[model samples]
Target: MIPLTEEQQMLQAMVRRMAREKLKPRAAEIDNTGEFPWDIVELFRENGLFGIHFPEEYGGSGGGVVDLCLAVEEVAQGCSDAAVILAGQALGSKLILLSGSEEQKRKYLPRIASGEFIPAFALTEPGAGSDNVSMQSRAVRDGDYYVINGRKIFITHADVADIFTLFAKTDPEKKARGISAFIINKGTPGLGIGKIEKKMAHKGNHACEVILEDVRVPRENLVGAEGEGFMEAMKILTTSRPVTAARAVGLAQVALDEAVAYAKTRVQFGQPIAKFQGIQFMLADMAIKVEAARQLVYNAAFLADRDYKSKEAQRASSMAKCFATDTAMQVTCDAVQVFGGYGYMREYPVERLMREAKVTQIVEGTNQVQRVVIARALLED
Candidate 1:
C-alpha cells in the first residue's frame, strides 16, 4: 500500500470514524426515503471535509488531491450516498479553482469551503452527455450580462445548490471551442429546477435537470475567457477521475469486507462457508482487485496533485477511473454471489453495494469513454 503522511493518515482515520458512527447507520434510511441528508452535510462542514482540497487562502486546509481522495474513499466505505455529497462539492468548485479570476475565487471559494453555499456543476444536457460539444444551451451576451438559455440534465445537487458553475455555447459554430463557463446564482430570474431523477443508487445525493430561460449572469461571473469552458471542464475531469476511482475502491472494499464477514459466520454442511475452497478463491480475487485498484487510484491522485495538465496525469487518471470502477462492479457482483439468496435482499448491504458500484462505472464519464481517453493519450504525439 502507498504510505500516507501522518496528517493524511489522521484525516483518513477521523473520516472513517465519522462515517462509521454517523453515516453508515443512516445509509439505509437515506436510500429508502430518497431524501437528501442535510444532517450529514452538516457533519462534513463541521469536520472540514469540504475544504480538504481547497487552498488555505480560500478558507481551506491547504491540502491536495490525495487528501481529497483519502477522505472520499473512507466516507464511501460506509455510505456511498453520503460520499457523493462530499465529492460533489469538490466537483462543483473545481472549474473555478482552475480558471476563476482572483475576484471570483475570493468571492466564492471561501463560501463553498465553509459549506455556507452549496454548489453544482452544470455541464451535461439531455442531448450532450459524453459529446459535450453538441449541447444546445446558448449564452448570448447582452449589454453587461450574458443571457443563458439551456437545459442541463443529470446535474448533481441542482435543486439544493446555492450556485452553479454552468457551461453554454457562446458560439455554436465552433463546436467545443464555442462553449463558455459562467457562475449563476440560485435565485437568478430565469433559473429554475426541473425533474429530479430517481436514481438506482446514491439516492441521498440528488441529480436533476436545471432549466435556464434567459438567465442573466453578469459579465464578471464568466470564468476564464470565452471559448475556454470545454478545456477547463476536461482539465477538471482529469483531476477528478482519481477521486472517483478512490470512491470505487472504497465501495469494493466494503463489499469484500461484508462478504468475508458473512462467509466466516454463515454455516453450510455443518461448517462455515469460508472453509470452502470456492468461497476462499472468491475472497482472494476480490482482495486482489481492491488492492490493485487502490494503488492505481493513489498513483493517479499523486500525479494530479503534482501537475494535472501533464499528459502523464491525464492518461493515469483515465486508466485509474476505468479500471477501479470496473473492479468495483466485478467485486460487488462476486460479493452478491457469495451471499446467494441473502445478497438479493434489501436487508443485505452487499445488494446496495452492487447497485452503487454500477453507477461508478457509468458516471464521471463512462468506462467506455475513459478507455477512449486512455487510447488517445497513448497515441498523442
Candidate 2:
C-alpha cells in the first residue's frame, strides 16, 4: 500500500469532491459534443488546480508527485477529459522548470502554475511516433536565432496552447541526440495550427497538428543544453507517465464501480445479475487488476519524487502505464458487457468510459513501446 502525506490527502479529497460536483454530470455532454472542456479547464485554473505541484515561488501550492497523482486520479474518476487537461498543464510545465533558464521559468512558470497560461509539448510528427529519431523537422542556426521548420502531429491541447514546449533537430548527425527542445509562442511567425481531429476517446481533449515554417525563436528559448532534447524528452516522459498511470487506475476504478452498481441492480433469471457466478468472477478480476495497477502507479510515483534520476523511473512508469491502461481497456469492455444493450446506448456513461480506455493505451507512449522498454531494461540489467 502507498501512503500519502496529509497535504496530499487533503488535496485528493478536495479534488474528489470537485470531480463529483462539476465533472461527472457534464461528461456525457462533453463526449457528445466533442468540445474541449475549456470551462472546466478554467475552473481548474481558478481553483489553483493547475499549479498545485509546482514550487511556491512560481505561484504553485508547493506540492509534489503524490499530490499530483491524487489530483489526477480524482479528476479522471470524474472525467478523463478534465484529468488530461490537468496532466497536459502540469507535465508540459515540468519540462520548462526542469530545463529552462531562470528567465524562461520566471516568464512562464508563474502564469502556468497560476493557470494564467497553458503549455503544450510538441514532439511527435506525422512521420514519427515511437520512432521519433526518424523525424525530419529541422532547426537551423541563423543570427542568434533558430529558424524552425517542422510539423508536429497529435499535440495535445494544440488549439488552446499559449507556449509550446517543442522539439526540433539541431544536428542530424547526432541522430536523436541531436534534437533540441524549444519554447515558442503560438502566434509566432509561420507557426500554424491545423483543424482539430475527431477522436475515439478523450474526445473533449482537443488535439491538432502544429506547423512551423521558417519560424524564428531566440537562441535563449532553448531548453537545457543543445543536442540534449531527446534525453530531456525521455526524462519528462518518464516522470510524467506514472501520473498518467494513476489516471488509468482511476479509469479502471470507475469502470469497476459502474459494472458493480449495474450488476447489483439489474435482474436476470428471476434474480439480480450480481448473483450469477459469471458476473461475480468478472467483477473480482477487475477489482484485482485495479488494485494491482493502482499500487504500481503509486509506488512508481513515490520513487520518482525521491529525486530518482530517471531511467529506472521510466521503467517503472512504463510498467505501470502499460498494465493500468490495459486493465482499464479490459475492465471497461467488461463493463459494457455487464450493462448489456443499455451499455451500447449513448445514454450510458460506460460507453464513453469504454471509448476513453482505448486512447490510454495509445497515448503517453504506446503499449508496444512499453514492451520494448521492459525488454531493454532486462537486457541492460
Top lDDT model: 1
Candidate 1 lDDT at 252 equals 96
- What is the C-alpha local distance difference test score of each model? 0.93, 0.88
Task: List model 1 lDDT by residue over 136-197, tens digit each.
Answer: 99999999999999999999999999999999999999888999999999999999999999
For 1-381, candidate 2 gives per-residue lDDT tens digits of 687778888888899999999998888888888888879978998788988888898888988776788899989999998899998897778878877889898999999998878899888899899888888889999989999998999999888999999889999999978999999997999999986788887888888999899999999999998989778778777778887888888888998999999999999899999999999999999999999999888888877777646667778888988999899899889999999999998888888888888888888789999999989998999
Candidate 1: global Cα-lDDT? 0.93
Q: Using TM-score as the measure, which candidate wins?
A: 1
Residue 243, candidate 2: Cα error in Å is 1.7
